[model samples]
Target: MLVTLREILEQAEQGNFAVGSFNSPTLESVRAVTEAAEELQSPIILSHAEVHNDIIPIEIIGPIFIQFAKQASVPVVVHLDHGSNLNIIKKAIDIGFTSVMIDASHMEYEDNIRIVQEVVDYAHKHNVSVEAELGMMTSSGIGGEETQGGEHHATQEAEDYYTDPLIAKDFVQKTEIDALAASFGTVHGIYVQEPNLDIKRLKAIYENIGRPVVMHGGSGLEIEDYVNVIQSGVRKINYYSYAAKAGAQAVKEYIQQNQNLFYHDYTVVAKQAIKEDVKRAMKIFMNNGY
Candidate 1:
C-alpha cells in the first residue's frame, strides 16, 4: 500500500528496525525494490533524486512509481530525494510522491531553514511528508559528478559541515521536517576505504533532535555499522550505488557466461539480473526476514 513517509518512519521507529529507501531510476529498479519488499514482508521506500528526474523525466517515471507502490503487498512510500529547488519539490508533490526531501544543506543555515520551512508549509498543506538535510554529505561517486558538474571526485574529510546536536535541536524545532538526515561522519557514494561511523555523535544528535533520523550514503557501510546506526536512531537508510552496480554486474556476468547471448532477450536478462540483486540486498536490509 502507498503510505506517507511519516507513517513509514513511525512504524520503523516503533518496531526498532530501519526501513530501506532505495533509488529507482527505471522500471527494472522499481520492480527489484518492490518485489524484494513484498517477498521480505518489509516496508520500503522507492526514492528518486532530482538528478534522476532529469535523466528519466518525471512525466514518464512518476505514474509508474505510483502504480508500483499501489500494487506492492507491503507498505511503500514513493519519495523524492535530494531535491534542491522548490519548484522540483512541488512537482514531486503534485506527481503523487508521498514524501519530498528538500536538500538545501549546501546553503547557509538560515537560508536552508527558510527553504525547508517553505517546503514544509506547502507539503503539510497537501498532506505530504518532508525530509530536510542538516549537513552536506560530500561524495566520491556519480553523485559528486552530478552535484559538482563533473568535477573531480574528492574524499570528504571529517569536517564540521554535519549537524551539531545543539543546532540540530533548533533546526528541527524551527523547520518541523518529518525526518532529519544527519551527516555524522558518513559521506555520499562509495568510500575509497572503510569509513568509520561515529555512533556516539549519531546517538547524541538523535537524542537532541527528538525525531526519527535518516542515514544517507549507506551503500558502503559495514554490517556492524548498519546495526549500530539503526540502534542509535536511524529509522531510514538510503542505498543506491550498490544496488545499481549489482544489477549491472549481474547482467555482465550473464552475458559472459552465455555463448548464444545474441539470441537472448534483453528485458528478461535485465529483469532477472535486477531481481537477484534486489533479493540479495533485501536479505541484508531485512536480515533474512523473508
Candidate 2:
C-alpha cells in the first residue's frame, strides 16, 4: 500500500531499523525494488531525483512507480529525492508522490528554511510528507555537473557543508519538515576509497535534533558501518550506485557468457540480477518485518 513518509520513517525510528530508499531510473529498477520488498515483507521507499528525471523524464516514470507502490504487499512510499526546485517538487506532489524532498542545503541557512517551509506547507495540505536536507553531498575528487543548479563541488569538502546540529534543530522546528537528511560524513556517488563515516557526529545530531535523520550515499559503506549508523539514528538510507552497478554488471556478464544472445534478451537477465541485488540490500538494511 502507498503510505506517507512520516509513517514510514516513524516506524523505522521506533523499530530501530533504517528504511531502504532505493533510487530507480527505469522500469526494471523499480520492479527489482518493489518485488524485493514484497518478497521480504519489508517496507521500502522508491526514490528518484530531479536530476535523474532530466534523463528519464518524470512524466514517463512517475506513474509507473506509483502503480508499483500501490500494488506492493508491504507499505511503499514513492518519494522525490534531492528535489532542487519547487516546480519539480510540486509536480511530484501533484502526481501522487507520498513524500517529497526539498533540498536547499546549498543555500544559506535562512534561505534553506524559507524554501523548505514553502514545500512543507504545500505538501501537508495534500496529506503528504516533506523531507529537507541540511547539508550538501557531492562527488569525490571528480568534478561533476551540478544536477540542481549549484556550483561544481567535491565530496572531500563535504565536511565544510556538514549540517550544524543547532541549525538543524532550528530548521526542522521552523519548517516543520517530516524528516531531515543530515550530512554527518557521506557524499553522493561512489567513493574512491573506503569513506570514513562520522558516527559520533551523527549521534550528536540524532540526540540533539530530535527527529528521524536520513543518511544518503549508502552505496559504499561497510555492513558494520551501516548498522552502527542506523543504531545511531539514521532512519532512512538512500542507495543508487550499488543498484546501477548491479544492473550493468549483470548485463555485461550475461553477454560475455552467451556470445549468441540477442541484446533484447538481456533485459530478463538484468532484471533478475538487479532483483537479487535489491533483496540483498533489503536484508542488509534489516527492515524486514516490523
Candidate 3:
C-alpha cells in the first residue's frame, strides 16, 4: 500500500539496495511503475516533476498517484521532484504526497540552508518526508532554461561543482532532510558518453552524512554504475527519460509496422514498453529482484 519515502528508503538502507524513483507524467507511466513493483515485490517511488506540471498539473496528478499507491500490492510512494516553490510543495503535502523535494541547490549554501530548513521544519510537522539537493547536479546553473524540471544535470560542473562533503554534512545536520541528492558524476538524460562515477566522492558524502543518499538523472547510467551507487549507499535513484522514451519509441514502431494503427493499440504498446523498462530498472536497483 501507500508508504512514506522515509519508510521506503529505510528498508533499502538496511538491505544495502536502492529503490528507483520513476517519474510519471501520465497514467500509463504510473501503471507501468506499479506493475513492475508488483512483479518484483519491490518498493517503488512514483514521481511527478514540477516542470511536467504544464502537461499534467500536480494537482490533477496527485490524486491519481495516491490512488495507485494505495492499490498497489507492494509499497509505493508519491513524490514531488525538484519543487522550488514553497506554496506548491505545501499544496503537494496537503493533497497527499508521501514525499516532497525542495531543490535549493541553485542558491548559495547559506540560502539553501535557510530555505531547506524552512521546508524541513514544515514537512516534519505534517509527518511528510523532505528531500533537498545540496550540490549543483547539472552544469547549466540554477537560473538557466533547463533547471526547471528533471533536466539531467550537466557534467561540466563535475570538476569544480561537486558537493563538498563537509558542507553537505553540515547541511544535513542542520536541515534534517529525510534524504540528500548530492552530485558525484551522474547527470540527467542520455549520456553523450559514458559517465565515470566518482566513487570516492560518493563514499565520502555517504560517510559524512550517514543518511539515505539520492541520485538524480539516472536514466542512462550503466548497470555497473548503478551497482556501485547502491553499494556506495545511494538509497534512491531517479529514473525517467529512459522509461518514457522506451514507451514512445515502442508506440512509434508499432504504428510503422501496422498498416492500420488504432488508438487503443498505441496505449497498449506504450504500457507494455514502459512496464518492461521499469521491470528492467527495478531488477538493476534491487540487484536482480530482491
RMSDs, each prediction?
Answer: 2.6, 2.2, 2.7
List the global CA lDDT of all models.
0.80, 0.82, 0.85
Ranking by TM-score: 3, 2, 1
For residues 1-290, write the lDDT of model 2, one tens digit per residue: 99999999988877889899988887888988888899989999998878887568787888988999998899999999888878989999889999998888878878888888888999999999998888766565331222453322462465776777877778888998888898777766657767878888888888877889998777768888888888888889888776777788889988788868786677777778878887887898884234
Candidate 1: Cα lDDT at 188: 69
Candidate 3 matches the true fold with a TM-score of: 0.94
Worst 10 residues of 2 by lDDT: 143-152
For candidate 2, report its TM-score: 0.94
lDDT of 3 by residue, 71-134 (tens): 9899998999999999999999999998999998877789889999999988988889999998
Q: For model 3, where is the 10-residue window of minimal lDDT?
A: 139-148
RMSD of 1: 2.6
Report the CA-based lDDT of candidate 3 relative to the real structure: 0.85
lDDT by residue (1-290, candidate 1, tens digit) is 99999998888887788888888888877887887788778898999878886679877888899999998899999999888868888899999999998988877889989999999999999999999988777676654225522112344356555668889999999999999999877766657767867788899999999899998888767777877888899888888877776666767877888777663455556767666766665566566221
The Cα RMSD in angstroms, rounded to one decimal, for candidate 2 relative to the true structure is 2.2
Q: Output the number of the lDDT-best candidate.
A: 3
